[model samples]
Target chain A: MKTPVYFDYAATAPVDPRVVEAMLGLLGPDGDFGNPSAVHAYGRKAAALVEEAREEIAALLGVAASGIVFTSGATESDNLAIKGAARAAARRGRHVITEKTAHKAVLDACRALEREGFEVSYLVPDRGGRISAAQLEASLRPDTILVSLLHANNETGVLQDIPALAAAVRRHGALFHLDAAQSAGKVELPLEQVDLLALSAHKFCGPKGAGLLYVRPGVRLEPLLHGGGHERGRRAGTLATHQIRGMALAFRLAVESMAEESSRLAGFSSRLIEGLCALPGVLLNGHREARLPNIVNVSVEGVDGEALQLALRDIACSSGAACNSASGEPSYVLRALGRDDALAGASLRFSMGRWTRVEEVDYLLERFGSELTRLRRIAGAA
Target chain B: MDELHDPARYSPRVLELFDRPARLGPPPGANREGQAENRARGSWLRMYLQVEAERVVAAGFHARGCPHTIAAAELACEALTGSDASELAEYRAEFLEAALPLPPEKLDVRLLIEDAVRAAAHGRR
Candidate 1:
């Protein structure tokens, strides 16, 4: 059976073997089984390893170890960052700002905040999927307490200018939080100036169940999930030593290989964009130059994304976020970027990864061209 | 090979009944006469069928689906012809027993034939 290529790395990535190896010791009987908060020597060993891993991840991102707090993954981190911050800052202002295309975690948290009576402004992006820095500045009101924007879009790979937008939010005294789930390991992030930021290890070849939330020293957040008070009262749980170690390894590897992977994936992404663009009536969804090197979103008219997806069973792609696949609605991201419902519904998000090969790309191009032709015929356009 | 185009494997019983492919049915269409002549009020596999009782005429159809849907549409028109309310009202999926049975997933197509028979028989055919 012929299967399509796997081009949905932005959704999730296959954990590297190195991460698995690092995790083994922690899961085994010989590993650090004791809790970090315990008084026993085994607990001390485990606690030290967790702290070391935190430092490792911090080093990779060029941040202080004290600023990094471990969470279950990106989703939890986003919730803790937005909901926690919004609720804590509710006394100051109940109004907050964010782009409509943010990952569901951010949006859901904002929605939950909305239920609690905090007003949220979901900024609509321009045609290229960029939330203009000026628009963000304009949206900030005296009542707005926080501005939460994504670092890189999960569906379109659209990269937002963090420092620029953060500066705008800073002027209004609202906290700035960045969801770097898709950008953290693959690209450089401006973590130094931002009040808060979130990251997940799995997006960058790290192990699953490991993520980081960066809260500036002075920022205040009400904990979203209550537990044993493990993460300096910000989060409470026994740290998963193996997951943290694996994440630290993955983070270090990603940082060290960034220069290499970025260039390589950029080349592959360029080839993909060029090949797809050659087809008639196809359009690009995100800012061509302002997006991540590894992601490309394309719209092929006269093709049903679901049908094309079903037809290209071998090549794994995502029409939108993994969370919204069941809804089968047009991508909210593309729609925010001014895409019509039909065009948004017809889009395909192909994100390149560390293991992507030129041959696989070539195969995808062939498959896409053929599938587009067939779908058009079925729709009577061809 | 396109296994879809060959009609030998399928049947033209629906088209044979209406004996007309006027591009209009009970839902909506360009020809007022053809649409008005068939009350065929219901949904075909791809088309919507509506029948008018007063004139025994049927008209108008809208097909927002595929070829199998369009073909089943043609099947709908056949499933309703030369019959009045009592005669064609009894037609059922058994009517399709002699023709190509759609896969389990394509039951929507069968629905088209059923509605067509009821509407055309009781409608303004």
Candidate 2:
């Protein structure tokens, strides 16, 4: 059987062949496979490669190589940034602020802090899925030590105004942390304004299990792991050199192609939105103009979202419905936007990526139209 | 992962039935009809049964749910068409559970189908 057409880039992207080639060079016996911490010739060779990879990743964010701390992925980076920063600044303040629509990594990290006598204020977003800088200013307290927010929402693709929010956080004398897992390679980031940022390689066609957190010089963070003095003692583990090389290559490639790729993706998104909105009761879920180019989330009327997903089996996409989840609840991100359970359950997220072509988009539009018509008929809506 | 080991995602039977559902919609001249829904999960099933001399002559179902639920609903309709009307209650959760080998998390699907079948059977009685 043919593979389903992949449109779930927001979930995870396929590893680019160029990235894979770079990684394979560092993995075999003939490659730089020695531990960076060792003192042998092989170790020196491996250590140099790791440093070069660090610089490549840092160049994309316009940050210093020394400030980068490698981790397993965005979740780990998020945990290190939020929990580590909050704990290190506990004496200064125990209050932390974050948006309601942040990824689970950020929200759960804040929640864990809340359990440790830290007060957390979750700022609710406007209906357009944006948390205004004014909202952040209002939520900020003298005791607020950190404010964590996502640069782009994974589910809705809504882009936040990080520069404005960072300025506000700075004015209030608190650290600003950005979860840029979804936007790192896809959009331009204001690195100088953000004190801390988390990025995952897989979001932009790199390997999984390799990510980094950018901690500005002089930013204090309590180390989450303690052992060998790796990642400047912030995170401790032998680095996966192959994965790191792949991530850096992918990040660099993404940066190189971002401008052209973004415009092309925006066109695809517009076509998708136009075609989907033609169906009755279909509503766009996020800010029409402020969201990222690759993602389009919409809630359809008069059809069960899960059934529609199944009907569009040829299109590999995701639904906001919690049918696949153990809790069987609708998407919390959708619910945060004031959508009811039914509407939230009916939402679908279509995220296109580098490999997506116009023909595939056209096919998806036709397939989706037919499936929605069939489902609506079964539900007696048409 | 291989399809044989990952029972949680999709089974061949479920995928086959979902791709081309059998006994969908109310059959013509059906006397008994019942509907069941799990509002939280957005699963709905409606069953139609035609009974003659205390035996089910025909059965059909219309469903708007996940692939597992749709397949289960279709399977229930197909299974009950030749079954006795009095034996409807016997087609409980375990019966469908064994047939579909559905993931444990999807037991609610079985309940929805069972509810529809029981309702249609009661209406016939």
Candidate 3:
């Protein structure tokens, strides 16, 4: 069977071999099978493994080890960060601020918060999936206590100016939580002023079952899962030793190799951009030059994004809109850019990853160009 | 490791299953009937097929998705021939198991094929 090229890395990445190797020691009966809470030698060994993993993950983000709390993955980390922070600081303020296009985890958490009677100011991002810092500053109300913005958009790969946004959020003394699921290992973020940050290991080539929430000093969160007071009463469960160890290894490898990896993915992503741009009536979506190095979103007029995706099944790219392929509904991110639904619906997001290569990009460029040309003609596009 | 997104060990059948894509819209002449067939690509919905057929022959698909999707639909139609709607409903991964593997992301293409089958069942000429 021919191996298909994978371009949807933002959804989740394959675990790195380094991570898989690191996890092996924790899996077998002879490994660290002792429950972390058991004070015996075995338990102590397990506890040490968990703590060491914590330190490694924290160090990757430049945060104190104590601030890192491991969870099942990014979704849980996001839930814990947003919902926990909202509850922990609820008395200080009842209003929370966040932007649209946040991963569903953040948006859903905010929605849940609203259900619990907290008022949330949903910031509509500017075109390119950016929520303006000035708009955020203006949206601040005295009652607002937490501001959560995604560090990088999952769909568009648009990187938010976290430090600038964080600096503004600080003025109101509102706690800031950045959902760094897309950025933590892919790019460096300013840790200062980011009260809490969430990351999932899978986004950075780690195991899917492990993730961490960075709660800066003095920032506290109510536990999401209740048990034997694991994670200092924040998240409760027997630690997932293998997954946690794998995540730590993944983070270390990603942090150490981020520069070269970023450069490689940038080249790959631009290759897609250049290739897609060569198609007539093609449009590039997202903030030009302001997005993550690996993401290239574009729209070919008269070609349905999903249809194009279907045509080029040999290359596993993505369409931003979930609706029908023939009928055009613009991408929500593109719509935020004031593009009518047609342009938005026509948008496609192609993200490059560590495994991406020039050969794969070449195949993708060839397949995509032909697919668009064929789909246009088949769809009767004049 | 199969523990992750390992496409490495994917068998020919598994690869074909993941890669073979069905169409998203019904065939060109399908909508004239009471049923409007919508293919989701992985799972198919054939509602309102209130009768049984002795001999069935149909030509379909207005390619709405991609080459793989169109090919998958064509493959589905060919496979479903000489079979009844009930037989069509039970069509499993074999067609694709014989074809190219479907990607995890494009798995919906399979459902679209099923939808085409149902559309063909109640499908109007």
Candidate 4:
């Protein structure tokens, strides 16, 4: 048996071998390893590959290549989109909106904006972790300049109704920024209503250190980095030719196989969730039908979250509690949905991906059930 | 290996007890039991001791907490068994601290174990 079978794909998928193969062509002396900004022949070759990758990624996303501004992965992309859009539109309004359960990148970015004298309204999602369209509409103010939200939540795999939320933001004349790091390649991104969208290649089996933010043609953004005139003055770092190539190729591959892969993963998710919920005191964490197909989160009662994780040492899964020896903090995402600190900490998040096997899923279910029972028995809950 | 299971994060003794806490659950012929709970951290431990002729003959416990807290309970129970009942009053969580090598954040957890042990002793009179 493979040791530590991975089910934490939502954290980051292993880089596809194809992506690795594509990246290798751009490195070393014989490859096109030249500064993309130079007018030399090598530079021109490198630049051409970057442009080709841009076009490839744009085609997969069904958007114009010119709209894509490549950055150093989702965290930077998210910071750039939220801060850039908010700062660019600051003269128009000082108010922004997001949900309480948004990723730390999004939440911390909004918090930083607040320090800059911008007002932010963090709307609480319903019990099922859905930010209703009506709830968003009521929060929109005349001075609301930007509304940043996630298409799919990272922790619970719960997807927000982007189309409805986008329409609400559109009617209120606010620019909508989406942190689609978790949703891109997994779901169809309805960008027609989105003003800015953030994505990380690693989320879809692309290389690390590669990501992009799509800014609609007319959307103005204040540049986050300043020095070089790269990315048409939006992002200013020297282009990472290999990482970008790998990211584009990975995105294309994932999107190409999206339909079939979505169905397959949905089946796996259903099987895993069913097996988990069958266990005594185990609960499915997110909405049954309204979540991403690859991610399954559940909280097991009467087991220490850390102990349960240790028991399943052979299964690489995540606990809702971040278990540093010093601090045991429950996931704020779970807390936002009204889960108590204990249950939230005891939660497990198993995210399957392209490499996941049905046999591995069954093995996980079996191990999870037996280990849970043992832990409960030790805790005297059985 | 995940960092949570890293040997550096916890001692071998801690993992040993956590994997198979031999003193878990109520011991047979237990006339006294005491429990302690940290509602904020969501850690709880119940210690059951069987005392004969003012000396602890057996000690066991059930706990819900991180590995450190659970290990501390198991260690406390092991130390209490076959000792004079007055030793329960003298037993310091500090001893388990060195045995489990608990961090400062988990100091309270060790104290919780001590509280349970002292409670079991208090129930005798």
**Judged by lDDT, which candidate is best?**
4
Model 2 Cα lDDT, one tens digit per residue, A1-382: 2447888999999999999998998888999999988899988888888899999788777889989999989999999999999999999999999988999899989999999999999999998999989989999999999999999999999999887898899999999999999998888987899889999999999999999999999999998998997988899999888888899999999999999999999999999999989878899998999999999999986667777776776788889877744557888888899888778888889999999999999998888888887766555455
Preferred candidate (DockQ higher): 1 or 4? 4
- Give the DockQ (C-alpha) for candidate 3: 0.11
lDDT of 3 by residue, A1-382 (tens): 2446788898788999877877887878889878888989989998999898888777767778988888998899989988998998888888999886777789889999999999998898877778777999999989898998888888778888876788788888899988888887778876876888888889889988888888888887877899789888899999888888888898899889999999888888787888888889888877877788888888767655555655565666668655433333345556766766556666777877888878888888888787676665444343
Q: How far off is residue A183 in model 2, in Å?
A: 0.3
Q: Local error of candidate 1 at A336, Å?
A: 1.6
Local accuracy of candidate 1 as per-residue lDDT tens digits, A62-134 = 8788888899898999899899999999999899899898999999989999999999999988888889889
Report how far residue B114 has shifted in candidate 2, in Å.
3.7
Interface RMSD for model 3 amounts to 7.7
Residue A150 lDDT in candidate 3: 85
Whole-model lDDT for model 4 versus the true structure?
A: 0.88
Give the Cα error of residue B8 in candidate 3, in Å.
Answer: 25
CA lDDT for candidate 3: 0.72
State iRMS for model 2. Answer: 3.5
Q: Rate the local accuracy (lDDT) of all candidates.
A: 0.73, 0.87, 0.72, 0.88
The TM-score of chain B in candidate 2 is 0.87
Cα lDDT of model 2 by residue, B6-60, tens digit: 4566777887777677676777868888888987776788888988787888888
Which candidate tops DockQ?
Answer: 4
User: Each model's TM-score?
Assistant: 0.79, 0.92, 0.76, 0.97
Q: Which stretches of candidate 1 lie over 4 Å from their true place?
A: A320-324, B1-125
After superposition, candidate 2 runs with Cα above 4 Å error:
B1-5, B52-55, B82-94, B121-125
Q: Is the docking of candidate 4 incorrect, acceptable, medium or high quality?
A: medium
Q: Quality of candidate 1's docking, in CAPRI categories?
A: incorrect
Kindly report which residue stretches of model 4 are placed more than 4 angstroms away from their true locations once superposed: A322-328, B1-4
The fnat scores of all predictions, in order, read 0.00, 0.56, 0.17, 0.69
